[model samples]
Target: MRKISPRLIYFFGALGGLLFGYDTGVISGAILYVKRTLDLTALEEGMVVSSVLLGAMIGAMSIGPLSDKFGRKKMVMFAALIFLIGSLGSAFSPEFITLVLSRIVLGIAVGGASALVPTYLAEVAPAKMRGSLTSLNQLMVMSGILMAYIINYAFSGMAHTVSWRWMLGFAAIPSAILFIGGVFLPESPRYLGRIKKFDEALAVLNMLREPAEAQAELQEMKDADEVELGGFKELFSKFVRPALVIGVGLAIFQQFMGINTVLYYAPTIFKAIGMGDSASLMGTVGLGTVNVIITAWAVRVMETRGRKEWLLIGGVGMAVSLVALAILTNFAATGIMSYVTIVAMAFYLIFFCATWGPIMWTMIGEVFPLAVRGVGVGFSSLVNWGANLLVSLMFPVLLQHFSMPIIFGVFAVMCALASFFVKRYVFETRGRSLEEIEATLRDRANVAEDDSVVAGTTPIAH
Candidate 1:
C-alpha cells in the first residue's frame, strides 16, 4: 500500500474540526428558529443554546486521559460516532429538554475533537509544515461553521417548519465522513512512543518523513517521552508556569473576546438591530463567509509572520474592531448603524481568524511535552469550552439587560485585555520543531538526549 502523505493526514484528521465548527456554529442560526418554535424564554433559550457547550466542557475534560490511553485516532473516531448520534438525536427532538440533551451529545464530540485534532496534526506534520497543517483544523472548523450558515440560509424558506432540525441534523453527513477517515488515519507517533511501540513509531514517521529526518525526529520524541509521564504536575513550577499561563490564558481570552457570542448570537443581534428573519440569517452567512475566507488567508501568513507576532497583531485588530462596534452602535439606532455593525463584526472575525482563531490551537498543541500533550490539551480545551459555555449561556441574558453597544463594549474591554495578555506572556513559537518547543517549555534552550532505539519497520497494513 502507498504511504499516506502528511498533508492528506492533516486534511482528514482535521475533519474532526469540521464537526466542532458545524455543531457549535449551526446553533447560532438554529436558535433563532428554536426560540420561535418552542416559545422559549431568554433564559431557556440560553440553556438550550449553551447545553452543548456544557457537554463540550465535560468531553474536553474526559477525552484527554482516554486519548492518551486508547490513542488519539480511536478517541477521535469515538467522537465522530458521538457527533452522529447527536445529529440524529437533535434532528428528531420533540421538545426543548430533549433538544438540549441532543446538543450536549454533539458538544461532547466537539469537545473531544477540539482537544485531539490539533495534537494529531501537530504530531504528524513536519515542523516546517506544522503551522499551516494544524491551522487546517481551525480552517475546517470555520468552514463547517460557514457551511452551517449556508445550510441555515437554504433552509430558511422551507415550508415544513423543521428547518432547524435539518440544520442540526446535517452534521451527521460530515461526522460519517470523519468516522471513515479516522479509521484510515495513522496513530500519532508521539502516542506510539508513549506506548513503547518504538519501531512502529519509527515506521510511521519514516513513511511520512525523509529517512534521516525521521530518525532525528524519532530521537527527539524519545527525549520527549522521557518526561511525558505525569508531566502536567510539573507545569506549576517556575519556568513551566509561563508556558502554562500562556496556553491557558490564550484559551480563556479567545473565548472571552466574544467570538462565540457573535458566532452563536449573530442572528439574534442582527434581528435586534431590526433585520427581518431572512436578513438575519443572511447576515450570519455573510459573517461566516468572511470568517472562512480570512482563515484561509491567515494560515499562509502565520507561517511567515510567526505565531506570537501575528497573535499580537490579531489581538490589536480585534480590540479595534470591537471598540468600533461599541462606539458605532452607541450612536443610536440609525439605518447606517446596522451596516456598521456588520462591518465591525466582519472586521472582528477577520482579525480573530487571522490571529487567535487558529493560533491558539497551534500554540496549545505545541506547548506541552509528549506525555502531557493529551492532558494539557484536555485541561486547556476544558477551559476553552467552559469559557464558551459561559459566554453562550450568558449572551442572551446580557443582551436582555444591556444595549448591544454596552454588551459589545464589555467584549471590547476583554479584547483589549487579550492583546495585553498576549503582549505580556506569549512566546514566539514559529518555525520550531516539537522537540524545540518542548525544550522551551522545559526551560532548556536545547534538547537533552535520552536513551532510545530506532525500531525496525514493517509495511503498514492498508
Candidate 2:
C-alpha cells in the first residue's frame, strides 16, 4: 500500500466534519420549504430543527466509548455510513414526524464526527501543527456549511414539491465521500497503543513521523496509556477538573454566543428584515463565505498568534456586533437596514470563525489527557449539542413572542459572559503537545489540592 501523506490525513480524515457541516446547514434551507409544504406551526418547525440535536446528544454519548474501544477509523467510517443512510431516509420521509426521525438518525453521525474528528487530528499531529490540523476539521465544517448554502439557494428555484427534497438529498453526496475516504485512513496510534498493539501503533506512527520522532511519540503514547487509559473517573479528580470545566464551559458558551442561531436561521432573520427568499438565502451564502475564509486564515495563524488572544477578540467582536445587530433590527423593522445588519453580522461571524468556531474544537482535542480524550470530548460535545438544541428550538418561539432586538440582546450578553469565561478559564494550547497539556492539567489538580490543605492548616493563628 502507498504511504498516506499527512495532507491526506488532514483533509480526508476530517471528512466527518464536512458531512456534519453540510447536513446541519442544509436543514436551514430545507426547513423554509418544508415548513410551508407541511403547513407546520412554529413549535413543529422547531421540533423539526431540534430533533437532530437530541439525536446528536445521544450519539455523542455513545460514539466516544465505542471509538475508544473499536478504534477511531472504524467508528468514523461507521458514522459516514450512518449519515448517508439518514440523509436518504430524510429526503424520502413522507411527513414531518418521519423527517424528524431521519434527522435524529443523521444527528448521531454529526455528533460522533464532532467528537472524534478533532481527537483523531490531535493524536496524529506534531505538536507544532496540531492546532492547524485540528482547525481543518473546522474548515471542512465551514466548507460544508458554505456548500449547503449554495445548494439551498440553487434549489430554492425548483418546484415546491421537490425543492426541499433536493436540498435534503444533497447531503448524501458528502456522506458518501466521507465514508469512502475514511476507509483509507489509519487508526489513531494513541488508540492502538491504548489497546496494547505496540508494534502496530509504532508502524502507523512511522508513517506520520520520522523514525526517531516516531519512536519517541510511541513512548509518549505508552506513557499516556499508563497515566490511566480511558480513565473516565480520572477526569473528575482534582488535577483534571479544571480541564473538564474549560472544555464543557467552552462548549456551552460557544452555542450560547448564537453562532448557530445565525447559521441555522440567517435566512429567516434576513426575511424578517424584508428580504425575499432568494435574497435572504444569498445573504447566508455571503456569511458562509466569510466563515470559510476567516476560519481558513485563523487556522493558518493559530499557532503563530495563539488561541487565547483570538478568543478574546471574538468575544468582544461578537458582543459588540450582536448588540449592534439587535439595535439595527429595529431600523430594519421600519426602514432600510441592509448595510447595518450585514456589516454587523459580518463582524460577528469573522470573530466567531476565527476564535470560538474553530478554537473550541481545537482546544477540546488538546485539553483532555489521552486516557479520557474521547469521553471528555464526548461530554463537551453533549453540552454543545444540548446548548444548540435549546437555542434552535427556542428561536422561532422567541421570535413569535419577543422582538428580534430582545432576543439578540440576550445573545450579546451571553457572548460577553462567554468572553469573561475564556479569559479566566481557557488555557492556551496552540502549539503544545497533547501530553504536555495533560501533564499541566494533572499538575494543576495537584496544586489545587495543596492550596486547599495549606489554607486549612492556619498554624494555630501564629
Candidate 3:
C-alpha cells in the first residue's frame, strides 16, 4: 500500500466535526421557516430545534463503550451513515412529528462525532503537535457551521417552506464525504495497543511517525499499559477523578455560557430587533464567518499558548461582550442598535471560538487515560449535549417569560462562573504526551490519597 500523509488522516478524521457543525448551524435559519409551516408555538419551536440535542445525548452516552469495543474509525463511519439518514429524513419530512424525529436521529450522529473525532485526533497526533491537530476537529466544525450559514442565506430568498428543506438536505452531501474518507483513515494506534496488538500498533505508528519515534512511542504505551487498567468503572476511580471533574465541568459551562443561544437563534434575535428575514439570515452568516475565522487562528496558536490561558482570557472577553450586548438589547430595539448588537455578538463569538469552543474538546481528548479515553470523553460529551439541549430548549421559552436583557445577563454571569471554574479546576496539558499526562495525574492522585490517609479522611476526585 502507498504511504498516507498525516494531513490526510487529520482531514478525514475531523470530517465528522464538519457534519456536527452543519447540522447544528443549518437549523438556526431553518427553524425560522420551519415554524411557519408547522405553525409551532414557542415551546413546540424549541422542540423542533432541540430534538436533535436529545438524540445527541443518547448518542454520547452510548458511543464510549461502543467505540471502545468496535474501534473509533468504525464508530465514526457508523455515525456518518446515521447522519446521512437523518439529514434526508429531516429534509423530506411532511409534518411536525416527522421533522422532530428526523432531527433526533441526526443528533445521535452529531453527538457521536462530537466525542469520536477529538479522541481519534488526539490519539493519532504527536505530543508537540497534538493541540493543533486535535483542534482540527473544531476547525472543521466551525467550517461546517459557516457552510451551513451560507447555504441558509442562499435559500432564504426562496419560498419559506422550500428553503428550509434544502438547508436540511444539504447536510447529506458532507455526511457521505465523511463516510468515504473514513474508509481510508487509519485506526488509532493507541487503541490498537489497548487491544494487545502491539505489532499492529507499531506498524500503524510507523506510518504516522518516524521509525525510531514510532518504536519509542510504542514502548511508552506498553509501559503505561502495564500500570493502568481501563474500564467504565475506572472512569470514576480516584486516579481519573480530577480529569473527570475538569471534563464534565467544562462541558456544562461551555453551554451555560449561552453560546448556542447565539448559534441557534441569531437570525431570530436579529429579526426580533426589526430586521427582515433575509437581513437576519445574513446576520447569522456574519456570526458564522467570525466563528470560522477565529477558530482557524486559534488552531494555529493553541499548541503555543496552552489551554488554561485561552479559556481564562476568552471567558472574561465573553462575559464583557454579553453584558454589552444585553445593555444594547435593553436600551434600543431598532435603528443602528441592531447593527451594534451584531457586533457585540461577534465579539462574544471571537472569545468563544478562539478558546472554549476548541479547547474543551481538545483537552477532554488529552486528559483521559487511554483505557477509558473513549468512555471518559463520551461521558463528558454526554454532559455537553445535555447542557446544550437545556439551553436550546429553554432560550425561546425563556424569551416568552423574560426580557432579552435578562437572558443575556444570565449568560454573562455564567461566563464569569466558567472563568472561575477554569482558574480553580483546569490543568494545562500543553506539549505533553498522553502517557506523560496520565502519569502526572496518577501521581497527583496518589499524593492526595496519602494526605487524606494522614488526616483520616477519604480522597475525592476534586
* Cα TM-score per model: 0.93, 0.96, 0.97
Clashing pairs in 3: none
Q: Candidates 2 and 3: which is better by lDDT? A: 3
| Candidate with maximal lDDT | 3
The most accurate candidate by TM-score is 3
Kindly provide the TM-score of model 3 when superposed on the true structure, using C-alpha atoms.
Answer: 0.97
Root-mean-square deviation of Cα positions for candidate 1 versus the true structure, in angstroms:
7.1
Give, for candidate 1, the lowest lDDT window spanning 10 residues.
Answer: 445-454
Please estimate how well model 3 matches the true structure, expressed as its whole-model Cα lDDT: 0.91
Q: Global lDDT for candidate 1?
A: 0.84
True-structure RMSD for candidate 2? 3.0
Candidate 3 segments exceeding 4 Å error: 227-229, 457-462
- Give the per-residue lDDT of model 2 (tens digit) for 397-444: 899999988988999999889889988988887767788887887677
Ranking by TM-score: 3, 2, 1
RMSD, one per candidate, in order: 7.1, 3.0, 1.7
Write one digit per residue (lDDT tens) for candidate 3, span 147-170.
Answer: 999999999889987899999999
Question: Could you tell me the lDDT of residue 342 within candidate 1?
Answer: 89
Pairs clashing in candidate 1? 228-371
User: Candidate 2 clash total?
Assistant: 1
